[model samples]
Target: MKALVLAGGSGTRLRPITHTSAKQLVPVANKPVLFFGLEAIAECGIQDVGIIVGETAAEIMAAVGDGSAHGLRVTYIQQEQPLGLAHAVLIARDFLGDDDFVMYLGDNFIVGGIGGQVADFTASRPAAQILLTHVPNPCDFGVAELDEAGRVIALEEKPAKPKSDFALVGVYLFSAAVHEAVRAVQPSWRGELEITDAIQWLIDQGQDVRSTVIDGYWKDTGNVTDMLEVNRSVLETVEPVVLGEVDTDSELVGRVSVGEGARISGSRIVGPVMIGDGTEVTGSYVGPSTSIGDDCVIRDSEIEFSIVLPHSSILGVRRIEASLIGRRVEVTPCLRVPATHRLVLGDHSKVQISS
Candidate 1:
């Protein structure tokens, strides 16, 4: 079996960050989210892989070339427009010919990997197998409704009134049968041929559609809020290792990973925190659940529960929390007289202020 990884989609939810970078390339624990999915597929012993890329194809290609680094020979399939998930499969028919394949969404993070799921699919050989997890807001995801026997009887894409809380996780297993299913389904009201519709078509035709309810951690890192949450979740498992220089004036507490060439001086770093390679943290308080990416500089600032990307700088800032800072960005102190209430004037295209 081969693997088809969907790395398309314009991540409008990630805003300015996505404007310059692909959402799948966003880092979790100083590593790109797409890397995790690729590694997982490689671990399953599948080397012939096809990656579906959209307008940002060049960026994705630059990041993942040849795929030999991950023990896979990757073939890039370009989608001129992201019509839908089913459309992705439609275009990859040649690459996925006759072989059962696993479709993985690049930006999704599923803890514990998909080794067990892949093994189960290989044994059972279902026409299509989808991973499901209970979500708070089912309307935001493709939802599945089960029968009395807990079989998936109906599926809907972002229903107004969801019949079940089971949201479709980003990983899916499909046999050659899916090609026929994709051909049978038409575009939904949204003008995109959703994969949910294709799976529903299989269900309607009495094909073997299976579901696996995942109990472990799973997240679709689509927006900033979810991205930060996933970052926090991954950092919780971080094992403390100090390979960098920590001056005597610096104090380290709890679980922290200090990468090589990182220097910590006159600072107090509390863990479940990661200081990436070649970074310098001086006279600052680095708190838990924070990932400072490689070659960054944090000076005279207190940061917690945040993700600071590579080559960024935070200087003389009093505090930053629950924030996502993009690469090469700079945050420095504002030079202004301190006052309890200072009248400020502004002009803007669109603004919403609460006072």
Candidate 2:
């Protein structure tokens, strides 16, 4: 079976960062989020893969190139616009012809890889199989309803009132039967061809639709908050290795990976932090769960649980936490006037002045 990875979203939720870069390319533990998904797909023994890309197609192409770097032959399928998940399948019909394929969202992070799920599908060859996880906010994701026998009965896309808490995870396994289902399903009210609708169509036709409820860690890193959280999660698995230069004044603690050419001096680095190649951290507190991208400069700043993109500089900032800094961005101390309160007194206002 081939693999179809969707890497084509505008990622409006990520704002300024997405404006400059593709959301899928955002790093988690100094590795592009999309790379993780590709690695997982590769581990499943799938060699031929198709990546769906949108407006940021050039950027994605530049990063992924021939896919040989990831041990796979990748075919780039341009989608013009991110109409929807099913829309991707519609356009990729030629590349995915006559073969069962796995559809994976590039920005989704699944703690345990999809090797098991792929193995199960390859063994049983289900008409359609979807990974599901119980989420508190079912309305934020495509949800599924299952029968008493634990079989999937229905699916909805971002329903106002969900029938179940099981939200569809980003990984999906589909047989050749889904090609017909995608053609038969109509666009939803949102004017996009949602994949959930295609799966629902199969269910209505009495086709085998399977759901695997996973309790493992899963996250859709479409927004900044989720991105930072995923970064923290991935860093937990880092193996401490210092391949760079560290001064006598600097101290490394816990599981920190300092890349080649990186230099840390007069600084204290907490564990589970990754400093990318050529990055320099001096006289700063690089706390746990932070991934500083390549060539970044962190001086006289204290950052923890944050992601600093490549070539960015954070200088003279006392504290920064839980932030997602974009590439080549410079953050410096504000050299402005002192703070002063300015307010207009109302008719019945009571005011007191500091001596």
Candidate 3:
């Protein structure tokens, strides 16, 4: 079996960050989310993989290369535009010829991996098998309506009034029969060919469209909020290992991983935190759920529940939390002027001054 990983999308939700970088390349626990998915796919023993890339194709190519690192031979399939999931499959027909394949969204983070699901699909050979999870807002996702018998009754893409809370997760398993289904479906009102529509086509043809509701952690790390949440989740399982130097003046508490050549001096670091290689933390309070990237410098500052990217520096800043700082950023104290309230008063305007 082969794998088709969809890494093409205009990540508008991530804004300035996405403007500079691909959303799938965003780090969770100092590692790219796309790498995690690729590793999972490799673990499932799928060696022939095809990655669908768009505008940020160069970056993805540079990072993944031959995919030998993940035990897979990757073939890059360029999709000029991210039309839709079904469109991706349409373009990858040659690469996925005749073989059953798994489609994984590049930015999705599914804890516990997809090995079990792959095993189950290989055993039964379902026409289409989808992973479903209960999300708070079903309207923002492709939702599934299941019958009392736990059979997939209908699928809707971003419905206004969702029939169920079960949103389709990014991982999907399909047999060779799905190619016919994709060919039979038409594009939705959104102009793009929706994958949900193709799956619905299978249902209409009496094909076995199966679904499994995953209870474990799953997140679509397309935006900042989910990215931070995934980061926090991945960090929870981190085993503390101190590979670098920690001065006598520095104190480490709880679970922390200090990478090679990283120096911590005159600082108090509380864990569930990871300090990357060659980083320096001095006279700072590094709190939980924070992953500081390699070669960063954190001096005389306090940060928690944040991700500081590689080569960034936070010096003499009072506090930072629940934030995402990009690479090569610098955060320092700004010169302060005398405290004063200056304002222009309009006619009949009443204002209260802080004295």
Query: Model 2, 39-147: lDDT tens per residue?
Result: 9999989999999999999999999999999999999999997789999999999999999999999999999899999999999998999999999999999999998
Steric clash pairs (candidate 2): none
Candidate 3 RMSD to the real structure: 6.8
lDDT of 2 at 233: 92
lDDT of each: 0.89, 0.89, 0.89
Per-residue lDDT of candidate 3, residues 183-276 (tens digit): 8888889888899999999999999999999999999998878888999999999999999999999999988999999999999999899999
lDDT of 1 by residue, 1-355 (tens): 9999999999888877787789999888898999999999999989999999998899999999999999999999999998999999999999999999999999999888999999999999999999999999999999999888889999999999999999999999999999998998899999999999999999988999999999999999998788888988888999999999999999999889999999999999998899999999999999888999999999987888888888888777766777778887777666552222111111111111111
Q: Candidate 3: where are CA atoms >4 Å away? A: 335-355
Lowest-scoring 10 consecutive residues by lDDT in candidate 2?
Answer: 341-350
Model 1 lDDT on a 0 to 1 scale: 0.89
Which residue pairs does candidate 3 place in steric collision? Answer: none
lDDT for 116 in candidate 1 is 93
Task: Point out where model 2 deviates above 4 Å.
Answer: 335-355
How displaced is residue 192 in candidate 1, in Å?
0.6
Superposed model 1: Cα runs more than 4 Å off: 335-355
Per-model TM against the reference:
0.94, 0.94, 0.94
